[model samples]
Structure formats: C-alpha cells, structure tokens
Target: MKLLFLIVLMYMFDQHKGNRLSNNPRPFEDIKREISDYSEVAKKIINLAVYGKAQNRSYERLALFVDTIGPRLSGSKSLELAIQYMYKALKNDGLENVHLEQVKIPHWERGEESAVMVEPRNHSLAILGLGGSVATPPEGITAEVLVVTSFDELHQRAQEAQGKIVVYNQRYVNYGETVLYRGRGALEAAKVGAKAALIKSITPFSINSPHTGIQSYAVGVPKIPAACISLEDAELIARMSSWGSKVVVTLKMGAKTYPDADSFNTVAEIVGSKYPEQVVLVSGHLDSWDVGQGAMDDGGGAFISWEALSLIKDLGLRPKRTLRLVLWTGEEQGGIGAEQYYKLHKMNISNFDVVMESDEGTFMPSGLAFTGSDEARGIMKEIMKLLKPINITQLFGNGEGTDISYWMKAGVPGASLNDDITKYFWFHHSQGDTMTVQNPMEMNLCAAVWTVVSYVVADMEEKLPV
Candidate 1:
C-alpha cells in the first residue's frame, strides 16, 4: 500500500506541475478535482483580482482615484479628505473590521516660493519647498550660491559654504541612494554655516519640474531654509560655477509648521476561518506629494491592494488566517504613517504571519524579495511553485518595502512585490508621475500575483519561518 501511494503521489505532483497522465484524456470532473487540491481558495482569489483589474482598468481607475483625491500631503486638508474617501472605499469593499487608527502628523504648509539667480545673469530656477523646511523671512535671502555634488566635497570646502546657499547637486544612481540627499542635505550644509541649502531634485529624468520631499534639521545647527531645484536649474548652476562665475540666488518661501493634525492608517480585513489569529498584511500608502497625482509612487499600490482584497472577499474563499490591508498616509513625507502604524501595532507583530508591501510602481511582476527565517524561506520556495504559472518565478533574499521594514525589525516575516522597475526612477518624485505610467494588463498581472501569494500565506496552517 505504501509503495502504491508513493507512485500515486508522484503522479499527482507531476500533474500539478502541468504534466499530463500518459496523454490520457480525463473527464472535466477529474481535472477539476485534481486542480482543487492545490488550494481552491487561492485560485479563486487570483481570478477575482484579475477580474477587478479588467473591469475597472487599472490605469484609468488609478487616475480617477488619484485625480479625485488630489495631493494627500500629511496634515493637510487634502489629506483629511483622502482619509475619509479611503475609509468609505474600504467599507464599500465589504471588508470586516474596517477602521482607522489615529496617527498624529505634523502640519507643514508650503506657501509661495520663488528662486532666481541675481548675479551672473538673471536666471529663475524652478523650486519646490521641502516638507518641514523653515521659510525665508518675508524679505527672502539673496546670497552667493556654492555648488557641491556631495557631502565629501562640502566637508572639503567648509569655508566656502559660510554665508552662502550651498547647492547639493548629488545624483542618485538609485532611488534609495538619491533619497539620502532629500532627507539630510540641509543638516550637512548647515554644519558648514551655510545660510541656506538647495538640493538638486532626486530624479533620473525631468523636464523642469522640481521634486519635493522631507528634510531633517540637525540639533544645535541654526535652522535654515532649504529647497530643491529642478534638474535643469541645477545643471545651469553647475555650468555657472564651472565658468568661475559667482552665482547669487534670491529665495523667498513662506513654508511654516502648524499644530499636529489628525491622520489615520486605514485598514480592511477579511477574517480567516480556522486560525483567525494569524494574519497576512498587504498595502500601500494613500498619500501623495503636493505636485502631480502620485499615481506611480503609491496611488497605484493602494487600489491594487484594496481591489485585491475585495476580490478575495467576493470569491467566498476564507483562508485559515486573516488577510489585512493597510492604506498608510504620510509615506511620502517621511514614512511617518508607517512609523506610527508600526509603533501602535509593534506588540501585535507576532500575530502577523507575513507582511507584503508594494511601494514600487505598478509594473509587470518580476517576482518577490523576502526576508524571514530559514523555514519561511523554504516555504516561500514552495509558494513560488504555485506562483510560477503567473510568471512570478524569481525570489530575492535581501529586500522588503519601506513600510514593512518596521515589521521585519520586529521579527515578522516581510516581503516586497518586485516589479519591472526599469522605468520607475524616471518618473519617481516628479510631476510626471500619473496613472498613465502603468499598463493595465501588467497591473492586472501584478494584482493576480499578489492575490496568489496573499491567499496562500493566509491559508497555510503553519506560520512562515522567521
């Protein structure tokens, strides 16, 4: 009996891998029975997500949603509007336990801003007020502009930065590396007693649009106004410097911080049947920059997760563990929403079976990057076998999304949906970001992949390793 069972098991496994049984035609009923053994709930979830992507048209749906929500900057009225819309949308999806967790966010308003090179010919530079930046006085500051491409250069020329507006023209080879300038350029410049700082927009491609992100103020350094200039303008400044001409810039901005505003992390859940305590989390941010619609940055990520969860709910396939979707706010500003969510839910980290984040733009699915225990790694390989049909066949050992980083630090298994990001940095943090950037079929494919992974994680009885 044992030998016969082993042979039968090997045959079934081959069939699961799409091998036919000796070219013998089977009845439709027999085929269905065989396929059902591979987790019917997971299959249904993938189908429903694919259907949603088709019906709504991922790009159009994302544009309509982003265009309507507008810029959802943290602590802004628009952000408040976005939160309400998201809450309603989650409830409409019929997700149980849908609610918002309060997160206090610092309010910073970007008032009127203008920059011009007064000396070495009159040249107006496109500028974006960085979040949390101190505004120049009503009179503004007009001073010589010193250009430096890196922190190392600034350190070498500390004397030149005094009483000048240091322009950090650092280029980012990758979004992760380039983003460092946006977060810390001001502090680095201020240490040299620079009157102000201007950073080159962190983008690989741009016409004249400037990118705005958050900057940190160093303790004990005199707080100074800092802003970002369009890539074109930064290049112009560099050209002037190479010519040995002093570039004086006039900057006027009215940015100011207000009292903390009430924000939220939106959550929707489909409860599990057997092990309801275990949960699989998936989501993206609901916020965008104050510039163009943040379609690619995260708006695409938000709806896909929402619609994916909705698809699972519609399929009537309850897994063994719950699937939770989170729509985080303030991801663009500094991941404040993610930080708050982590703080509030860190204690419940053990309950999370697997956490998946999709901050990368909605492009075709490449695979997934995972970080977890050795056992979880082995299970993921098995899971990959199920995903091979959908073209997600690769797995990376060293990646997780920015939002899920907190969970990973707290010992929860985390992963990121790796997309074909060859073009992601071109429009990242720019006005060029919009829904049109994504292909519908590819987005649908991505949604399908997410559904498969999420469902399998939720259905499995054992918690993913590490």
Candidate 2:
C-alpha cells in the first residue's frame, strides 16, 4: 500500500509539472483530493499563528527590531548595525544556513535641511530633502517661486521657470502615477534653469507631513536641490502664485552624496527534507528611509517573513524544497541589494521556483498578486484555498513588487502579498511610518498567509510551471 501511494504521488507531480492538464481537464473532486494534504497543513499553520502561543509574535518582533534600530537608510552606519541585529536574531531563531552576502551600495546623507518663505509670507515650510540631492549654497538659494502642476505646464512656461524655484503641486492620482514627479522633479526643473525643486508629498491623505524619497539626476544635466514639501505648504504657494502672488522662498539643504559603502543581504533558510537544491525564496528589504521607525514601510513585512520561517521551525515541519529568506539591503535607494543578488544568482535561475516579496504595506492580507503561467496560477489557486481559514483566498493576476520584479520578468514565478494598502503611501517615506500604523492582529494574519503559502509551495511535489 505504501509503495502504491508513492507511485501515485510521483505520477501526480509528473503530470502537473509536465502541464498535462492543458489537454486533459481533471474533475474538481480529484483536484480537491490532490490538495487535501495541503489543507491539513494550512489548518495547523493558522492555529499556530492566530491562536497558539505564536499569536502577535510577528508584531512584537517588528516592534523590537524597529525600536532598537530606527530608520536604516542605504549605506548608513545605523543600517550596518541593523544588519548585525538581524544576523544575530536569525541565528538565535535556529534557522539553518544563516549568513550574509556583501553588496556595494550608494551612500547619501540627509543633512540639516529647511525651507522658509521669505517674501509674501514668512511661514516656515515643512520639508525633507530628497535622497541624492545636492546641497544648496550655505547662504541658501532664495528665488522667485514658479508653481506648476505638471511637467507639461513647466515646459509651457519654460521662460518663467528660469532662475526660479519650481514647486510641483501635482495632484495625487496614485503612488505609481504620482511618484514620478518626486523622482524627476529636479531633473526637469534644472532643464529650465530652476535653482531648486520642491514636490508635494505623493499622498491622497496627509496631516501636514513632508515626505522624502530618492531623486535621480540625468547625465550632463546640472544637479539641483530636490525636496518634498507638505501638501498644505505646496498648495499654499500654488494658490498664492495663482492669485498673482510673488512667493519668494529660500531653501537650504546640507545634503551630500559620498562614495559607495559596504552592505549585505541578510539570509537564513530551512534546508529541504528532500530536494535541498531547489529553493522557494521569500524576502523583504531591511533598509528604509531615514524617517520614522519604518515599522509600516517594511519592518512589518520583514518580520512577518521571519515569522514564517519561525512558525515552521516551531512546528517541526520542513518542506521538500529549501525555503530561503533574504532580508535585502538598499531597497529604498532603487533596489541596490536585490539587483546584485539577481545578477549573482541568475545563473542558477532554474533552481529558484518562486520569489516572494512584501514591499507593500503588511496590512490585513486579502490574498496574493501573482505572476506566472496558467498552470502555475492553477497551483497557486489551490494553495490560496488553504488560506480560507484566515478569510483570505482571492488571488489577483498582476504580481508587482520592486525587489521581486526582476525575477518575475525573467520568467520565475513571483508572488506579492495583497493587502489593504489604501494608506500605504500616506506614511511611505515619511515620519508617519511607525508602529502606530501596524496592527498586531493584522500582522498575525499576514504572517499566517505568508507561512502557509511558502510552506505548501515548497513541500508540494509538483514544480510550478515556468
């Protein structure tokens, strides 16, 4: 009977991996039977995470991690300390193959920065200098303000922008659509000879908060100071400019870009019981903007991933394929660590089955956004069904994340946790991103889903179709 069961399992994996279901559709009952084993494991995971002793563990861990090591910006000394903190934490957790791989990353400091209205009004404007922005002169750059809502308007009034400070008050559409202004506001402003650029915080909702993010400089174009201003202040200046108000502002930023610094991608894993060479990768970047505690931006995501491995270990369950966790560095400054990881590991791309990243807020998880073939989606759907106990079982088609997109584009199956991120951008790259934005119960649910999906995918005999 045992021999027959093994033979049947091999046949099932063989048929599924070979994509035989395309020509031959099996009955739903057979599908249920095939996934029944996973359902049992999922129940155990839910119980451990939601009800057992591990409840709220991820949230507590995240709080400790972030509280101990506040914002971990790229190439900062605090970031290096944050890496050591995780290195010790993971080893203490009893995870196997714990180590770090060096990756060179950029270093930029947000020195003393401030902006104030000198003419028309003397109200101090809330500001946070964009990363990689050059410092303004010690005396500061006081210029006439040229308020424009979009790039087109800037081009339309190019003559007015010359020698003026361009304040971009672009309306909030969405993060992806609106964040472009934050990234390129300075480059565009410099084109028309603007001395500096101030962008409105890219959030639909804000309580007088100034956000900061990375800004890229074009080759051969003069670099100008770029910073994010509070929505209220930007709108104030824009409204003043609209009513024929001459709003002169003085912006001072001590920002500077140093040479590249050392960094590492912290790693830990559970070696497979069977095929140790095959890996199911899970990740969250450890680096964050030098703002608040960074609990919401990524501390929650990183700890939940750690919780996944911890839960499996506590339950004494090892998957058939290795489940590797990578805490990436330098993600905020444009995926500096993950990009190197991809270049280093792409040669063994076939060995990687799935790459999962959680850059989006770790709010109450709803389901997953996945990128893969139809057959792979079918497998993912079955796995998600096991998460029904947590009341999250819907899978979306578009799987997108900054760190994991590289693997997805290269045809490796990718998955990103789908959660209620309606307010993700509100705290993103800002001081509002702290433990107050995270819920313990929500983190528990997210950890459960992350663990269940990663475990089942690793243990399942069938390989996800590339």
Candidate 3:
C-alpha cells in the first residue's frame, strides 16, 4: 500500500508537468487515508480533554465566567466587563494576538415590567419585555385582550384588535416558525392598532418562564409595548377566549432603548508555522440575553472555543494555518458583532479555510452540520472519521450559526456544533439558561470534538476548497 501510494504521488507530480502539484481532485480513498493518519493525534486530544488533566476545565472556566459576569448582555456594563475579563484571560493563557476590536451595538434594557389579568379575575402573570420594546405609559395600558393563534387569524380579526392588547398564542412548531411571532408580533399588532403585543414564549415546554428576545418595529408604524408571556399564561388566555369569556389585562413595561454603545469582539489565536496568514476560525458569541446566567445559550459555546485553543497550546501543536478564537458580541441582536467583523476582515476571506461555531447547547456530542462544496464535505467526512473514538463522527448539511452565517453565505465553508439540543429552547433567552442546565462531562466531550476537528483541519495538507 505504501509503494502504491508513493507511485500515485509520483504520477500526480508527473501529471503536474513540473514542480507544482495539480489542483485537480484527489481520490476519496486517498483523502480518507490522509485523514485517518490523524487518528493518534485525535486520540491524544480526546484523552487529554475528556479523561486527562484538562477534563472539566471548560465547564469550570465557564462556571466562573458565568457566575462572575452573571449575564453579558450587549451594550451593557456586564458585557464590557466580560470582554475585558476574556481579554486578560486569553493573554494570561499565552495565546497570540489577544485583543479586542470595537463594534457599535444596540442597547435595550428591560426594566421593571408586569402584567395582571383584571377582567376575568385578578391574577398576575409572568412577563419579560422583549428587547428594544418601547415603554408603556406610566400608569400602564389596561384593555381587553384579543387572543389569536396565528397571524392569519390576527389579520382576519383586524377589526377586533383595535383598542386592545393583542395576544399571540401561536403554537410551538419550531424556532424558525414560532420565532416569527416573537420578532414581528409587535409590528403586526401595531398595523391594526393594538395597544400592546404579548407573544407566547417560543418553546415546546416552559415552566412558567417567559422567554425574552429582540423584536423589531417597522418605520412609519406606531411602536407598541411588547413582551413575552409564559406558555401556561398564553394557553390560559386562549382557553378563556375560546369559552367566550372576556379577558382584560393591565400591562406595564419600563423597557427603554438607549443610544448604541461601544463593545468589542474579543480575540485570541495560535499562529501557524507554515501558513500564518491562512486561518481556521473557531468561535461563539460572548453576548447573551439578560434574563439568566446565559450559560446554556452561549457561555458553554464560548468557553469551549477557548478550551480548543488551550488544548492545542497544551499539546504544543501548531497547525499549518492559524487557529483563531473569536468571542463575538451582539450576537443575540441579529449577529451585529459578527457582521461587523466579517466586513472588516472579508478582504482576506479567501485565506479563511473554515469558520466553526458552537452556539448549540454543549450537550452530549452528536456530530456536525456543515455548509461547503461537495469536495469540502467529502474532506470533512474523512476528518470526522478520526472522531470515532468518541463515537461522534457524523456530518449533516446546512451548517449554520447567526455569528458565522455571514461568512458561510459569502461562500466560505462553515461548521456548527451538533449535539443533543432537546432541551435547548426550554431555557434559551430565559432565566432558566443557567449553569445548572450545563453538564461538565458533556462540555468535556464537546471541547474534545471541537479541538480535534479544528486542529486536524488547520494542520491538513491543503485547505478545504471553498
């Protein structure tokens, strides 16, 4: 087999006609063999991160970070503190190019907010004012509730929504489908003169928790107070409305939008030996919703990214391409930080081989979801095979992350963590997104997978062709 591989290499060189190797496709078998050669290195990374000294290091780092910082909401003091803390930690870790790049980010604070059902009964309901929501009058808005299950129903009953608080009891279909209600419920309700908008939390299971997220108001449309209600309350309102009972609620929100504030994208890296300019980027957003410790939503993701760099540095493994760890800000606000970073660095987009993100929960590892050319996907398949030691060598399509989507859309290969996210939405953007939701063993496995994939890709013979 060695003689055959050598002969094949010589034949390829001869076909190149001179000194340079051909850019033509290599056999899938050859790629597999090349990737399999990293099995020993893969085992070393896994052992160190999962069973060796570094075990639970990421989780411990994340616990300290999350507990100390609390919640790193964009444009807040906590976010800035988190940025500074990460910068100092990265420098202390001895990673290269540790610094921050400034970004202008939105600032929306959810102040004291409350809701109470007054018509049918005097009952208080849990509420979390959506980000960027305008405040209600000091005394609050007390009006009849108009419950609608879907936008179609709301539009059909447009006349009924006037002088009322529009309550969207949209069923939980999926994040993409249901999140539309949370994001646009205010705008849609305002179109028909709703006094306020109350959207159901976007989750299949909710323990009376109201999930808060960013909501947008259209220009020329009257901005209305908007907030998210727990699933139980949403269902209660719907049930009352179904029985021809009148439900009236008083809503008061102190939500205020301040001027955009200064923030940063914290960065660190391990410079490559052979191709210093070329990069394999690993990242997760540092900013999160203000409701919880923000541990599950992205704290785990960010720390594991740092762990990948730490693991590589511990092993004294420098790849052919630089490995950069970017902790982005303003990711919850539609990925503003990452968008700015992309615009600033896109001139060298060709030098970026792959951008990896781990926004998904750091649950038990499953595999990866990737977006790239067929050739790149083929290469990734071979690389994943090395992870069989951890039993997480699977690859799906349409790799995505709000932070990395900009690069992926511009044709750069992108990869996002895929794990057991069955309970992700249950705590996302809510007070439930705390350290208790995260598991140390799961985090160790996630860090192992992240390190192995990133190191192998960075050290590979050639970039995964875009």
What are the per-residue Cα lDDT tens digits for candidate 2 across 332-404? Answer: 9889899999999999887788999988989988999999998789878888999888789999988877888
Give the C-alpha miss distance for residue 411 in model 3, angstroms: 0.5
Tens-digit lDDT track of model 3 for 178-218:
89999999999999999999999999998899999999999
TM-score of each model, paired residue for residue: 0.89, 0.94, 0.95
| Candidate 2, position 276, lDDT | 84
TM match of model 2 to true structure: 0.94
**Model 2 local distance difference test score:** 0.90
**For candidate 1, what's the RMSD?**
7.8
Score candidate 1 by lDDT. Answer: 0.80
The numbered model that scores best in lDDT is 3
> What are the per-residue Cα lDDT tens digits for candidate 1 across 1-466?
9999999999876533321123444544543343346555555555555553344555566777787877777788888888888788778768899999998877888899999998989978999989899999899999998999999999999998999999988876877788888888888888999988999998887788898888889778888898989889998999889999989999999998998788999998998877677789998998877777788888888877886686676666787788999988888766778898888877767678888888888898887788987656766766766665565768777657778888888888888878888888777766778766877777777777777778777775455655
Question: How many angstroms is residue 252 displaced in model 1 relative to the true structure, after the best TM-score fit?
Answer: 0.9
lDDT of each: 0.80, 0.90, 0.92
RMSDs, each prediction? 7.8, 3.8, 4.7
